[model samples]
Target: MKELDEANKKYNSDFVEKVKKTDVGENLKRIKIKKNVYIDSLIQPGFIYYIETGVVLRSFVDAAGNIKAIDILCAQEVMGLRSLIGRVGVQLEIKALEEVTILIIPEKLILANLQDAYHFLCSNFQYTMSIMYLHWQAMLSFGSERINYALIALAYYVGTEKDGEFFFPPYITHDVIASFASVTRSYVSRHVSKLADDDILVNQAKKMKIKDMDTLIKNTPNYQSF
Candidate 1:
C-alpha cells in the first residue's frame, strides 16, 4: 500500500511536471490565497487554475443557506476545466483550506499553444473520472443504513498522512462532516466521540486523525471493492 501510494504520488507529480514544461506554465499567473478565502467564479470565466500547493474545498450553498462540501482537491489538481471548456457556468464556491498557491492559465491560450490538445484533455479527463469515482463512492456510502461508516470512508478518501497519523487536511469540523454525510451535527458528534473512545480516531488541536488506517479501511463500506 505504501508503494502504491508512492507510485500514485509520482504519477501526479510527473503529470504536473509535464504540464509545467508546456507553454501554459510559461504564461501562468501565480496567485497566493489565504485560508477561507472564497474564489469568485465570475472573476475569471475563461481561466482554469492548477493547484500548486495546499488544499481547496469545493462547496455549494443548499436551499437552507448551508454550505455543503462537494469535493476536496489537493496539489496538482486542476479546477474550472469544465466551465472553461464546456462554456458552463461555475456553480461551486471554491474555498481555500489552507494557505494556497495557484497558477492561473487562460483557456484560450492553452488551446492555441498545445500542439496536441488531446493529451491535455486526456489528463484532465482522467482527473474528472477519479472525482466521479469518489462521488459515486460517497453516494453509495450515503445510501447505506449507517452514516458513521460513510463518514469514515469520506475521511479516508480526503485525508493526508503525517507522522503515521492520517489527518483531515482542512481540519474539518463536525458541522462540515455532518453536512457532507447528510446527518445532524449531534449525530456526527456522537459517532466521533465513539470512534475516539474506541481509539480508531483521535482529535488533536481541532484536527481529526485516523489512528489506524487498516482498521478504518476494514470498517468502510465495500472495502474489498476499494
Candidate 2:
C-alpha cells in the first residue's frame, strides 16, 4: 500500500491517494465548521488546512466592501497556500458551503512534510494556472470552443454518474455555473435549454446529463467546421 500510494502521488499530483481518509469522528482533534466559515477564517497564526469535503470559495471584497468570488474549490484544494509558501495569512476568504472536516497542520510541519510532494505541487501549479487561463479566455473567444471546454471541465469536476451516464451535479443553481462560465444565468439557461431540446443533453431530476458526446463534437453552436 505504501508503494502504491507513492505511485498514485506521482501520477495524480494531489497526494490524495496517500492521505489516510479516516472518518470525521475518528480524528483526535476535530474542528467543527459551519457553513460559510468566512474564507479568511481558516488563516490564523500558524496552521494550514486541507479540504475534507464541501466547497471552499476563494473571494475578496472590493473597495466598497462587496464580496466578489474569484474561485470555488471542492475537495483537495489546499487552503492558504500563499501563507504556507511564505507570507502573512491569505487575503482571500475561504468559506465552506457545508459542514467540513479540514485537516489542520502547522505551516512549518506541512513544509517539513513536503520533501516528497514538492516536485508534484511545483509542476502542478502550471497545470492549475493553465486551466484558469483557459476558462478565463473561453467566453472571450469568438468560436464555440469556449463553451465546449467549460462543459468538459464542469463534467469532470462536478458531474454525477447514473445508469452508465455522467451528469452535471444537481442543484447547480444557474447562478453558480454562470459565474465560472462567464455568462449570465439567463444566457446559460437558454443555451442549456437548447441543448436539452436537441437531445445533446437532458435535464433529468434537475441534473444535466451529457447524453451525446459525439453530437457535441460534431455540431457545435456557432461553429464552422470543414
Best by lDDT: 1
Every model's TM-score: 0.76, 0.67
Q: Report the C-alpha lDDT of model 1 over 1-226, residue by residue, as the tens digit.
A: 2333334445545545555577543776889999889875533667767778988778777777876676667776667767676665437888887888888877656666455445656655665566556556665664222345445645556667777677775457787677676667787788777778889888766878888766766766553323
lDDT, candidate 2, at 163: 64
lDDT of each: 0.66, 0.56
127-176 per-residue lDDT for model 2 (tens digits): 45654565555555443344554565556556665664658764355555
The per-candidate count of clashes, in order, stands at: 0, 3
How many times do residue backbones clash in model 1?
Answer: 0
Candidate 1 Cα outliers beyond 4 Å, as residue runs: 1-26, 142-158, 162-165, 223-226
**Best by TM-score, which number?**
1
